[model samples]
Target: MNAPFPPAADVGVPVEQPMLVEDADAVAWDQSTDLLVVGLGGAGLAAALEGIERGLSVIAVDRYACGGSTAANGGVFYAGGGTTIQREAGEDDSPEAMLDYLRIEAGKVVSDETLRRFVEQSPETVDWILRHGGKLAASVWKEKCSYPPLDRFLYHPDNSLVASYRARAKPAARGHRAFGRDGKKAWGLGKFITEPMTQSALRLGLVFHRYSEARQLVVDRDGRVVGARILSTPEGSPEARRFAKYIARANMLLAALPPSIPLASITIALGNHYLRKASEIEAKARFSRLIRAREGVVLSAGGFIMNPAMVRRYAPAYATGMPNGTLGDQGSGILLGMSAGGATALMDKVSAWRFINPPKAWAQAIAVDRAGERFVDETVYGATMGEHIVDYRGGVAWLIYDKSLREAAFRQARDPKLVPFQRDVTLLNLLFNARKAPTLDALARRIGVDAEGLVRTVATYNAAARGEAQDPFGKEAVDMHPIERGPFYAMDISIDSRFLPLPVITFGGLRVAEESGQVLDRAGKPIAGLYAAGRTAVGLASQTYVSGLSFADCFFSGRRAARHAARANV
Candidate 1:
């Protein structure tokens, strides 16, 4: 038996210290609200909106500008089980099938009840978003469901991989997306929803404090969350501090010479003098404002994908990748909750996406490992393929295809029925990296894989493509085939691509109750008056994340937490 490598130390992410009420009796309180919502992205916006709708005073803060990764995502919400659009389109769907599929993909991280609620109430959530100016062009439905929760309202294929793993779930496309200018006008992504949400929250009277980073949760001696301590820089001219004393001396003489001075000039001079004194009193000013939440504090700050320390401590595979998160996604919220005794889970799971499912041109080719052997089902989920390649195949692989298949795909490029919209982007980019050679051996060497192994794999696959034998990998030969024809084409598709690097996100976070989005302590008890939602708290995507699951969890959990916090005891 062989021994394994010793595990690395938990060089954890940095988090600010919590302000104890007993220790800080002299700090000035800047704002007091019923609910304090941290972060201004999808989850934080949702919480602030819910708090406002419930008639609770709300103050929301963001470390940077608004618009987190939610605005810049593919924007498909996996709503299944005969949602309003599915029913209107007369697409057959059942909650049973959705539950089966989701249970398989989601594994055991989410409680059945919460997953069920997410599936069932999704229509309501969609409607709520729309009512508040969000958009979803549900009138259009595609054949294949992109992610899980099988229902035909979306546009992607069934989960054959899950079924191969022995989970009996029917296939259906269940992604519901907003309408925007990004794709075909019918295929809007996350921005269509997140932008309207931010606008609505602002219009509904929620106080939004931009560029204010929450450093710590304020807890009382009894372990109840009272508010938050935010780190911010005062928004003023720096020149005022430089000229304070000069203005003060001029103001002192202004009273004696004011008879001939204009009123406006006097007012301006007096304002500058006060600013000067204020600057003197606040030299090298430290702006740490205290925000008191009368009822509760909802930590909706995003996940820690941008923080290298957190990535190193948790999922080191995610330590390197193109981040799909806001700059403020520094593990602050998760660390804050943990410092308050919150427990966490699935911190090691991450999404390393290499979108190879499209251009179906790539599908006709086989992804070969260093040994020149096919590793995964080409038609399987893209992220799963990414996992296999990164985890098992040395973080790189090559896709070998023939000219005939490429020609076929090029001919069908304009046919929307045969190809997804905007897949040409990948196809065009691939042309720059695609390599060609006369023989399989020459091509294998050119692409840097094992020539002998490539010859064997190609010869056997060619025989199958030519209808002489069945494919060992279960690939149908209708569109793919026969490397017997000369002029072979191969493209390197791996965890790293200079033109189009693989993007990733971290989904694990602070553990919370299945019923409410309350932050849970290490002892598994709720931290009084402290709640969390979005990627900052573990939810539906605790095990395997898909396109819209994070957004859906944010909306649902945000509403749930706000509902509980609005009426909680101070």
Candidate 2:
């Protein structure tokens, strides 16, 4: 019988047709398993491992290598609520306190009950990760930083330390960084988290298909997802295997270079060349296979930040920012779920990070819009700052700093405790892009802001710093420094800056049942035998993003989906 759906193509565009193939029985299945997982990222690895532990046979597939965007991340897992590491580090915390803080951060994105459940299970979740060979240091990093240095493994990655959040609930460092094997590399720490779990899953009979893309959902007449149609490079083809090996080798070579290395751009270009060659080979050798998922199908394929068309459609404001995710995060999983009648929520929500810290002095400076009006607390988390800029300030803003703050930031850059990546980027922005003038009026004119407005704003800020008035943005006294010294500077922190790129990630996806990880339709009904985890689902970070929330949600939702799917009748 002819397949109902069109043949999968490598068009480099978002899948538009939902790609639903009904009448699963008519199609010839190449293989069968208890659960079929699409996209072997953090969530897929977790789901596969959990399924195998529950004695269910599982098969997983990914568009690239086994690691997706997760492996490219900082490897921070946000877990608190009296976790072993938190207690070991001499921090006092509880589930109620966590929920109270998250209630503000998470907002009404999830129900009170669902948020409570996540908070209550936080400690156990850390324990589970530790059991899987994931290692985290018990030492707490007590400093204001966008991300901790390579040697430090624990820090606060959210607004928990802000005055308002601390007033609501006690603050504690919850970002549990995975122990990285490569000390010099600032990123790819997520490998430490995924590699161990992936190894465990592989040892327990989880079959993972690399360079395979799931293009369509196979559903029964009852509207139940039964399997998936995957386009994969021929496993036995020598040429395809050789190209795959080349891609892996290139990635390893790129990972060895430090972020501060001058030859980094050339190496990155060469790596892209190898990836393109491998993609060409994979495309030519591609063949379709139908994998019957007897129990259920879990979509852990990650978010669509890398998909330009989807970004244009859902979040046009963030199109100028640097897309932050691997090639596999092209919204294929969300598209597959939609094809199975899954409804998506929070499609316009994107996390564009403009981290102005690591040299905490920079954040103490006042951030002004094009009109020279102060908009937000300069010391808030990067996501909050980025949101205010993109959503409210017309994607344009500048950080105004005094000579003392600039000098202090330069001194902090010299500190050995700073991450090399952060240090290099900070120096580049401060040295090259910052516009300097003898006075605030001259600085405002140089940066194309209202001169009078800029002068007035700085005067108000100075009054507050002098203890004569209250800060309009509620910035704490310690962080409020008067910009009175001459030679004021304005650094372009806009979303579209080429030198200082704002890394963006999508925070919206298929809406799922809170209790079970089942994908829900428009009418709020679960799409049977279909589930989603990680960025593919509207989970904890769908509303607002912190550094480690998505990774934590991957573990929570992936395990939830697998445990529930394992009980399904096969």
Highest lDDT model number: 2
Please report the TM-score between candidate 2 and the true structure: 0.93
How far out, in Å, is residue 64 in model 2? Answer: 1.7
TM-score of every model versus the real structure: 0.80, 0.93
List, residue by residue over 339-441, the lDDT tens digit for candidate 1.
7778888787777766564566666678898788988667666666677777778788888887776775566455554324334545565567678898889
lDDT value for model 2: 0.84
Clashing pairs in 1: 75-190, 144-155, 144-156, 144-157, 145-156, 145-157, 145-173, 154-173, 154-175, 244-276
The digit string of per-residue lDDT tens for model 2 on 1-570 reads 111222234324434453355666676889999999998998998899899989899999987777787888888999999999999888888888888888988858889988988888899988888888887887678777898877778899998888766888888889999886576766788988889888878988999887788877887778888888888876657965786787786675544443334575777677777777887786688888889998899999999887777788778888888777777787888878776768888878899899998778788889999889999988899998998999889999999999999998999899898888889888988888789999999999898999999999999999988889999988888988899887899988899775677889999989999998999987889989899999999999888889899998898889889999877743
